[model samples]
Target: MGARLDGTVAVVTGASSGIGEATARALAGEGAHVALLARRRERLEALAGELGDGSSVHEVDVADAEAVARAIADVVARHGRLDVLVNNAGYGSMTPATGSALSEWRTMVDVNVNGVLGTTHAALDHLRRAATGERGIADVVTVSSVAGRKVSGPAVNVYAATKHAVGAFSEALRQELGTDHVRVGLVEPGLVRSELTEGQGAAQQAEAEQELGLMEPSDIADAIVYMVTRPRRTAVNEILVRPTEQAR
Candidate 1:
């Protein structure tokens, strides 16, 4: 039998590293042609090389609305159809609001909130069109955080706010797109060892150091693949994945 996503095309933002990279690889494994989107051209090129002919790289900053729109248009123009979009590009700066630089807060809002908004908006029409085609459905999966569900601590003040914004946006999008057969879902992870958590001093790492073992990017990737591969009648709207030991 053919793979579940054979003949489909998928776009994964922030594909240069971490969860985004893993998701791109996972989607390609399911036979979807993957479009790798990120700011680091060299990293994207390396990934594209690894994924071979099934993947293409686009150097883009998701926070830039125009660039994001162009990238999506390029993907559709090249592939003729778009089936999945993984909004995984994000920025995190964990510090008390009083001590944090205003620039850091602005960046968090741009990449975390604005990025999701622009990418989703650019792809909505195509996703809706794809829903009416052969596969009968399309998917929009945004990688959020456990902070999105609840504020874990003071250090995550603005970061938590951005995630909360994404959660609200995803829910509204889900309600609007369900009837169109375009599934909108959010994957809220607790602590994953990635660029965002490794050296960045993200609050999640401190939580992990307290004996809450971290999850790998692939774990979240698996959840995403599962969400999009379900039978057409199923719509996995929101999945919150935390480490087995993470309490809050």
Candidate 2:
């Protein structure tokens, strides 16, 4: 049988690893041509090879507005059309507000907040156009975090702020684009065993592995695919997914 997204095209940022990489693979499995975007050329190329045909890679830093715009344009040029954009490029520096340098906070804002804006701005025209195409729909899925839903700890100050920013933006975009048949959704994951989680201390990692069991990157990827595959009549606005043992 044919796949659900046959003949469609999808662009996934941060496709070099973690949730982004998993999302790209999942989209490709559904028969959408997947474009992997990340700063690491080697990793993207390697992933592209793993995904085989109907897959490509673009080296890009989401925080760079011009670079992101050009990358999206190139994807459209290569694929003929764009149907889905997964904004999964983000950073988290879990440092206390008092000790963390100003640059750290700013960097989080650049990648987590401004990056989303730049990609979304550049892809709006194409996404809207896709909605009117034969598929009659388009998708913009943002990989947010549990931090986006609520402020957790002092170390999550800037990261939480950036997540919150994206959450608000996704909601407003969903409101404005409903009539256009453009589905905007946010997947908020609590803890996933990725590079981001690996950055935490040994104690935290042990706790997660032993007590709560960190979620796999594919977990978040599945949530993203579900949001975009819904029938046109139903729009999944937001999904908050936490590990089974996570209380907050």
Candidate 3:
């Protein structure tokens, strides 16, 4: 038998690293032709090579609306259909509002909130069109943070706000697209080990490893795979994943 996603095409933003990279790999494993999108060209090229001829790379910053739209269009033109879209590109810098840089706040809103909006908007027509195809359904999965659900700690003011905005958008989009056979979902991860966390020095990293037992990018990737692979009649709309020891 063929793989579950055989002949489907998937576009993953932030595909150069972390959860995005892992999701690209996982989706490809299930037989989707993956389109890798990120600002890093070399990393995306390397990943595309590993994913083989079925995959392609498009280096575009998610913060640029026009660029994202053009990239998505290119993916469709090359692949003939778009079955899945992973809005995984994001930015975050945790600092208390009193001392936080205004630019940092704007960056979070641009990449986290606006990026999701632009990419989803660009893919909407294609996704709905794909739903009318042989598979009979299409998917949109956004990578969010536990911060999106609640403000768990200090220094997360603007970051949390941005995440919350996407959470709201995902819900509204889910409702709006259900009748179109487009499944919209969000995967909220809590404290995963990725580029964001690797910035902590070795000493701090070791301490965090001992304390939280950080989840790997593949863990979240598995959740995404599960969401998109569900039968057309079923939809797994939201999944919140946290490390076993993570309390918040």
Candidate 4:
């Protein structure tokens, strides 16, 4: 039998590392032609080499709306259609509001909030087209965080707010696109060993790692692959994965 995502074209933002990197690999394993998108050219090229053919790389800053639109167009133009878009590019600054640099807050909003918007908006029409075609469905999976569901801590103020914004956006898209056969979903992860978490102080990072036994990026990638590969009639809307030991 053919693979689950056979003949599909998938675009994954932030594909240079972590969840996005793992997700791109997982989707490709399912026979999807994965388009790797990230600002890091060298890293994207290296990963593209590892992925071999049926993989393409696009150097993009998701915060740039025009660039995202062009990238989506390029993907569809190169491939026949676009079946999946993993909106995974994000920035995190878990600093208290009082101590948070205004620049950090703004940058978080740009990459975390605006980035999702730009990519999703740019791909909506293409996804809808694919859904109505032979694939019978298309997927938009945004990498959110446990903070999206609830404020994880005091310092995650703006970070939490940005996550919350995406969560609400996904819900609205799900409602608006269900009839179109375009699935919109969110994956909320907690305390994974990622660039985002590594930003925490060294001692605190070690403590969190020791206490929670943090999840691997591949775990979240597995959830995403599962979400998009479900039967056409089944829509896995939201997945919140946390370390087994992580508590509120």
- What tens-digit string does per-residue lDDT give for candidate 2 at 1-248? 89889999999999999999999999999999999999999999999999897898899999999999999999999988999999999899898888779998899999999999999999999999999998899999999999998897889998999999999999999999989999999999998989888888888898888988889999999999999888889989888998899888
Model 2, residue 27: distance off in Å is: 0.5
| Global fold similarity of model 3 (TM-score) | 0.98
The TM-score, computed over Cα atoms with residue i paired to residue i, of candidate 4 is 0.98
The CA lDDT at 244 in model 3 is 93
Candidate 2 global lDDT? 0.93
TM-score: the better of candidates 1 and 3? 3
Writing each residue's lDDT as its tens digit, candidate 3 over 1-248 gives 99999999999999999999999999999999999999999999999999999999999999999999999999999999999999999898877888788999999999999999999999999999999998999999999999999999888899899999999999999999999999999999998888888776678778889999899999999999999999999999999999999888
Number of the top-ranking candidate, with lDDT as the measure: 3
- Residue-pair clashes per candidate: 0, 0, 0, 0
Per-model TM-score versus the true fold? 0.97, 0.98, 0.98, 0.98
Go through the candidates in order and give each one's C-alpha lDDT. Answer: 0.93, 0.93, 0.95, 0.94
Q: Model 4: runs farther than 4 Å from truth?
A: none
Candidate 3 Cα lDDT to native = 0.95
